[model samples]
Target: MGTSLLILGVALWAGAHFFKRLAPEKRAEIGEAGKGAVAIALLISIVLMVIGYRMAEPVWLWIAPFWMVHVNNLLLFIAFYLFAVSGLKTNLHRRIRHPQLSGFKAWAVGHLLVVGTVQGLILFGGLLAWAVVSVIVINRANRDWARPPEAPMWKEGVAVVGALFLMLVVGQIHGWIGPWPFGGA
Candidate 1:
């Protein structure tokens, strides 16, 4: 059940984002629902993540190389930093229009490499796969989209500060929530 839910969540997240590109009209219709549909989808995804994480049993399906952990952590950190940069209303947003998606892709792949639970594998692996494909498709499709060649220093500073704030939040969650759906203190 938990595995199924996690898969469903992955499907929802991936499908929602992808459909926006594949079927612009349909995506617009859903988007016209005034953010409610988006919010609902996000809510469902969160619930699925929580339930799936909680119900997942820690079983080693495959052994990751020792160096992979450090690499993955670094990737996750970079992902978080990109997400922070994307969230800020800085020139970074102008320079990197899809920083959030890029960040999520990195974060998902990093987790998939280290976290070997069924739910984690399904959710993160599915997302990582989608992210890769989406990047390719979006790049090809939106090649004509204009972009800024460079960002201002203030934007870079905002990205740095935002990353630090987000790092603090992640630490707090790790400490208070006790390692999320998986019991790891």
Candidate 2:
């Protein structure tokens, strides 16, 4: 049942996201209302995914070494940093076309490395695939990309600091919900 719910959530989430790309005419016809509907579906899918993942029985596929946790942390840092840079006017933003999606890909891959359970694989793998496809589709859709103005160095420093703060907060939340990221420290 949990697995089924998870699968359904993934399908709904992916479908809603891809709907615009798949049916641009339909999306345009719906207009702003379509965005709201998609947002609602995305919210519901997130809730379902969380509940389904927690409810699902763990079936270990492989054992990840303890060292992988460190690597996961590093990836997470990079992910968060990218996410922070995405919102800001940074020079990195000009170089990385899809900062948020790239962050998401990194995050999903990091989680997949640390979590080897069946549910983990299904959830993280699905997200990773979605992020990859999104990047590809978006790139294809926008062939001639215009470069944005570069931000100041100070702003980049601020983004890094903000990302670090966000990471700490996320680590705390992870500790509250599941295993502590820093080995229960």
Candidate 3:
């Protein structure tokens, strides 16, 4: 049942996200209420995912080497930085077409490294696939790529600072939820 819920949640997350890109006509037919409906579905999906993952029993697959901890941390840091770049519209945005999804992929990979269970594989792998497909779907929908003007250098600096701040805050939340991310407390 837990596994089923997890699958449903992941599927809903992907479906809800894709609905806008895939079915613009139907979405428009719903008028403004469609946005609210999607938001509600996304929220329910998050709740389902959280409940499902916790309810699912662990089925460990592999034990990560101690060294992978460092790799995971590095990837998470890069993920955070990429998220900041997306929001800040830093110079990196000009090069990376989809910083947000790329960061999401990185985040999923980082979690996959640490979590070696079947549920982890399903959860992270599903999200990773969704992120990858989302990029493709979006790129197909919008062919013309108009790169935004690079933000000022100070914005990049702010992104760096924001990355650091985000890392600390998210790391704290991560630790609270599961293993301590800093040193595996």
Candidate 4:
């Protein structure tokens, strides 16, 4: 049941997100109300994902070597930095068309390494797939890419510092609910 909920939640996430792009006419018909509907759907999806992940029984495939934790942490750090790049429109943002989606892929893959369970596979893999598919979908639909205005060099430094801080804070929060990521083997 938990796995089912998790799958359903992931499906809902994809559906809600893709609705705007896939059904522009319908979305336009709904007008401003569509935004609220999508937001509510996203919130429900998140709740289902959290509950499902917490409730699911672990079925381990293979325990990751302790050293992989460091690798995973590095990937997560990169992911966070890329996320910052996406928002800050740093230099990297021009090079990377979809930094946020790339970050999402990294984040999902990082988790996939440490979590060897079926539930982990489903959650992380599903999200990874979603990110990949989203990129393809977006690329196909939008041919022209307009780069955002160049940001000051200082903004890059800010992104770096902000990413580290974000990783620390989010890691701490994760520790409260689940496994402590910092130096935890």
Candidate 5:
């Protein structure tokens, strides 16, 4: 049941995301309404994924070494930094075309390194694939890439600090919900 829900969630999320790329005319037909529908679908899918992942039993495919946790933490830091930069008007944002998706890729890869369970593979691997495909499709859609206007450096600094705080909060939440990331393997 958990696996089923997970699969359904991934399918709904991916399908909704790819709908615009697959059928632009149809998407344009609905316009704002279509965007709302997609947003709702994404919300539902995320809820389902969270529930399914929590309920699913871990079936270990391979045991990750204790050292991998350190690597995962580093990757997660980079991922969060990228995610923060994506939302801000940073110089780095102008250079990195798809910072958010790239962050998602890093997040997925980091989790994959630490989590060797079937559910982890299904969730993270699926998201990794989606991010990769979305980046490719988005790049294709917007061929005329140009540099964005520069923003103040202080804003970027603030974003980085916020990202670090968020990472710490998330880590605490993860520990409360499941295995403590800083705990022994």
Candidate 6:
């Protein structure tokens, strides 16, 4: 069940983004399709999250040390911070051209560390692998790409601070939205 949902989530997410490259014209014409794809991806992603979380109960498929969990938690925290900071008009995104992708990699790696099931490994670990590849591909492709306007210093400062602030709030309420079965409690 978890594997199925994970596959679906990956399909939806990958399919949605992958089409942009294959059918750029169609993608432009059917703006709604992109939105639809994203919406469906999000919905399926939620379902996948639920399944993964439910299966991630205290029961261990294999022995995982408590120290590993601590490390996983730290990685997850960094992942969240990366995701948040990438959203702002910061140097990260401009410099990398794919801050979100980088963040996704971090987030996936963090989760993979915590969850050792094959299904969990396939889902998060697979995504992390993809992110790494995509980052390299995008970087190579855009090595000579044109640059966008630079953001002001004030905006950069605000983005960094705002990212930190958002992390705090998200951490406080993480259990509510996080897929971890034990997150909220």
Question: Which ranges in model 6 have alpha carbons more than 4 Å from their true place?
Answer: 52-62, 136-143, 148-157, 176-185
Which lDDT tens digits does candidate 1 get at residues 1-185?
A: 76777777878877767766888877777666836776778788878867876776665677666667677767867887898777664576676667878898888988888777666787788888988888888998888767655656777787777786776678577657654422232
lDDT, each prediction: 0.74, 0.90, 0.91, 0.93, 0.89, 0.64
lDDT score for candidate 6 against the true structure: 0.64
Global local distance difference test of model 5? 0.89
Clashing pairs in 1: none
Per-model TM-score on C-alpha atoms: 0.80, 0.96, 0.97, 0.97, 0.92, 0.71
Candidate 3 residues 17-76, lDDT tens each?
999999999999998999999999999998888888989999999988888888988898
On TM-score, the stronger of 1 and 2 is: 2
lDDT of 6 by residue, 111-154 (tens): 77767777677677767876776667666656775544676667
Backbone clashes in model 4, listed as residue pairs: none
> lDDT ranking from best to worst?
4, 3, 2, 5, 1, 6
lDDT of 4 by residue, 92-115 (tens): 898899999999999999999999
Error of 1 at 81 (Å): 1.6
User: Local error of candidate 4 at 145, Å?
Assistant: 0.7
